[model samples]
Target: MKLSVIGSGYVGLVAGTCFAEAGNHVICMDVDEKKIADLKNGIIPIYEPGLEAMLKRNVDHGKLTFTTDMKHTVHNSDIIFIAVGTPPDEDGSADLTYVLAVAKAIGQYMTHPKIVIDKSTVPVGTAALVKAEIQTQTDIDVHVVSNPEFLKEGAAIDDFMYPDRVVIGTDSDEVGETMRQLYAPFVRTGNPIIVMDIVSAELTKYAANSMLATKISFMNEMANLCHRVGADIENVRRGIASDRRIGKAFIFAGVGYGGSCFPKDVKALIHTSSKYDYNMRILTAVEDVNQDQKTILIPRILEHFGGSVKGKTIALWGLSFKPKTDDMREAPARVLIKTLHELGATLKAHDPVALEEARRLGLDKMVTLCEDNYEAIRNSDALILVTEWLEYREPDFEYMKKNMNSFAIFDGRNIYNPEKVRSKGFTYYGIGRQ
Candidate 1:
């Protein structure tokens, strides 16, 4: 199949590259001329693991190409995937302007019938809106299939290559058959290719994200209660996870979940429910819990410093939202830095991957970028473990003890054994652990 992914962002780039790797000729189109030029010059704009190598290989093989010309992209492809960003609006609803713009552009320039797939996570009924927009511009028939991506940013390549199941929504069997054919290669291990109504498919994306967000907040709330009751949430998590029904995945208590998907998708669902005068009470509380959870370490830091961070030099380990990627959108570390900075504390931070991204976001000025983990502890008043990177799990406590001004450790991820860390002559604080 000849495919055109109408965006050069994360989803589009990955999808176009992967599709081209699967023997499809792919043209990636975007309005940004500079970005198109960069892609043509073998420059990948994002930092995703294994993406650059795959993209370079596909480009070298003449299977994948990038362009700023929409007309050429529309006419040359049989299937056009609308993989643009659906950024959240001020009211929290997904802004569909980019998706609709691409649909109209495809309709205007398309000289033949094409299969249009909604690859971005948009609100329910967006496919209908897109179909209407496209039909208004052209008399030719277009099958607008709702096929939301289930890829995580850090592990997107693996997710695309081996999806657990592919949910393709279309009323027409013809469209469903076409989608199954496109995705069959990925699901050769007998993973399901479920075809359903367009509305159900749209809601599935929101429901999936909302459920995960709910679990994170629920665990955070549990962790908070555990702290008050002098219980360890980790033990509780283990106890509950053993139950066959509950199974552990997103049940871990941390500073809170922050990524491109959960925060925006949860808010969008809440906003969508509000439009119908329906209140998503559980989701509302979930959002509330997360907002407070992001700064859960602040009070602990204040307590350690006797209610004042003034003139305190704190060393912070990890700055990314999570680990394995440099994407810091809505990262909890930013919230911590902002809150701590307001209290007049000098922060020394270190991350294996997010240092450059942190600089790009202008967060470097707010905190000192440390060269290494032990160096981050150099003459610092206290240590805060924000992101749970693998390297920070077990460290040279002697080096930590030697370099730090104080032996107080505030672990946001509950990573360390409290007794062991305290044995190293340091005060250790972790979420829901005593």
Candidate 2:
């Protein structure tokens, strides 16, 4: 298959690269000439693990390419993927300007019948909207398929290489079979290729994200309650996770969930329901819980400092939303840094890969960006483990004890053992652990 993935963003780049790796000729197209140039020059914009190397290999092999010429790319490909960003609007609905723009451009320039896939996470009925938009521009029959991506940021390569299931949304069996053939290489282990209605496939992406976000909020609420009742959330999490039904995944009592997908998708789902004269009450509370959960450690920090953070220097061990990627969209560390800065507390933060993104987000001025985890702790009053990166799991406690102005460790991800930290003669504050 010859495929052209529009947008050249995270999803587009990854999907295009992976498809090319699977023997398809792929051209990743973007309107930004600079970005296209940078990609062709092997300068990846995002810091996803294993992406740059794979992209370079595919491009070197003549399997993958990058382009800014939309008409040339669209007319040359049999399958065009609308993989643009669907950012959230002010009213919380998904902003579809980019997706619709790509759709219009594809329709205008397409000379033959093509299979168009909605690889971006858009709201339900977007495929219908895309079909209608394309039909207005061209009389050619275009098959619009709703095939949402299920790739995780840090582990996108593995996820794309071995997908658990492939969902293809198309009314026609021919379109479904064509999508299945494209995805056949990834699901060699007999994982299902679920074929569903277009609307159902679009809703699946939102429903999946919302359910995961619900679990995260529920666990955070449980952790908060555990703190009040003098119980350990780790033990509670273990107890519940042992059950066959409640198998552990996102049950870790973290600060909160944040990324490009969950925050935007949850709000968009709520907004979509409102348009249909319905209220997603559970998801509304989920959003509220997550918003509060991001700054849950602020009060604890104040209590530790005797009700003030003025003149205090706090160290943050992680800045990204999670490990192995440099994405800072709606990251919990931003909430902590903003709140602590407002209270006159100076911050030194470190992440293995997110410093560049933090700098891009103007967090460098708000906090001291350090070179390493230990450097971040130098002369700090308290150390907070924000992202739970693997390197922060086991550290030289003596070095940490020697460099800090105060002996306090706030384990945001509960990756520390309370007894061991207390034995080191340092104050340890873990989420819902006594």
The C-alpha local distance difference test score for the whole of candidate 1 amounts to: 0.92
Q: Which residue pairs in candidate 1 have backbone atoms (N, alpha carbon, C) closer than 3 angstroms, thus clashing?
A: none
- Point out where model 1 deviates above 4 Å: none
Model 1's number of clashes is: 0
Per-prediction CA RMSD (Å): 1.2, 0.8
Model 1 Cα lDDT, one tens digit per residue, 1-434 = 99999998878998898999899999999999989999999998888889999999999999999999999999899999999989899999999999999999988997889999999999988999999999989999899999999988888899998998899999899989989999988999999999999999999999999998999899999999999999999999999998878888889899998878899999999999998899999999999999999998898889889999999999889888888778888999999999999899998899988898899999888899977878888999899898998999998899888988889999999889999999999998999887
Q: Please report, in order, the local distance difference test score of every candidate based on alpha carbons.
A: 0.92, 0.93
Compose the digit string of candidate 2's lDDT tens values, residues 1-434: 89999988878999999999899999999999999999988999988888998999999999998899999898789999999999999999999999999889888998999999999999999999999999889999999999989999999988988988888889999999899999999999999999999999999999999999999999999999999999999999999998989888989988999999999999999999999999999999999999999999999999999999999999999899999888899999999999999999999999999998899899988999999889989899999999989999998999989998999999999999999999997999998888
